[model samples]
Target: MAQQKPTKVMKLYNRVTRLPYGNKIFSLMVSRMAPYFGTIRPLITELRPHYCECLIKKRNAVHNHIKTVHVIAICNGLEMAMGVMAEASIPSHLRWIPKGMSLDYTAKAGSDIRCVAEVKPEQWVEGDLLVPVTAYDDNDVVVVEGHIKLWISAKPPR
Candidate 1:
């Protein structure tokens, strides 16, 4: 057969630079945490000027021995959300990378997972942006809340 068409996600990425970056960020995560997020495929569901949302369905592979979401998988969701939000908020002229992150997992993720990152870009100054990420379970319970700190690098890092 002829080559298959790229996915809808891939089609959308072609028209959006930030989304493509976020996609790359997700793909790169396997190296960031191989055994934990071994085949992480985050899909950007929504992206706008001030907000972003990504999603990853929960599978047995992501569950811990107790059948709860693995801690590292929660970390993966947190990072994906932050990346999407950062892509939406930061300008292409400026480069930024996540320097630090803080997370609190309050609830256990039990089913398909949703990661939402929302922020008021106007509230940030020139040097740093705090991307807030919230992950919820299938029942809409907040499983985790976190923030990713990104360092701006339009110029050389000081």
Candidate 2:
């Protein structure tokens, strides 16, 4: 079989992440691509095949009554990481969409949070797949853990 080319999302990531202020540019691009994601004010810290990382600061807009990061905000961050991973890793022949997510709030997020998601190399395939994601506070405590399911399939013949 022939090697597949990188997806357009990955190509854009690679292109911008090479220049100065690339991270900022990538973040803006992601927000534009998914307007809902922009609401959480996420910063795309890393993006690569099978892995993605994002940071969301603790701010009033994202805080709950208890003055900690809201659960929904954390969820948004998790999805963003998983979405980027899926976009960068899925083979060119296949397309994917998030089916659902299973999540657990392990701890209170008292500070800025960093979310990371990944799919093992062996797990890449053409079908339903779950990508694991975890979020940590500045102190490195795992605040959330879960998986996002993505339905993957070959594009219909044009």
Q: Give each model's clash number.
A: 0, 0
Q: Give the per-residue lDDT of model 2 (tens digit) for 1-158.
A: 45558778889988998999898899888888899999888999988788999999999999999999998999999999998888888776678888999999999999999999988766777888988899999999999998899888898988
- Would you list the C-alpha lDDT of every candidate in the order shown? 0.66, 0.89
**Candidate 1, 1-158: lDDT as tens digits:** 23334433344444553654755564444335444443545555665555666667677777888888776777786686666456545554466778888888888778777788787645444577778888888889998888888877674455
For model 2 the local lDDT of residue 5 reads 81
Question: What overall lDDT, based on C-alpha atoms, would model 1 receive against the true structure?
Answer: 0.66
Question: Least accurate stretch of 10 residues (summed lDDT) in model 1?
Answer: 1-10
State TM-scores per candidate: 0.70, 0.93
Candidate 2 accuracy as TM-score: 0.93
The candidate maximizing TM-score is 2
Residue pairs clashing in model 2 are none
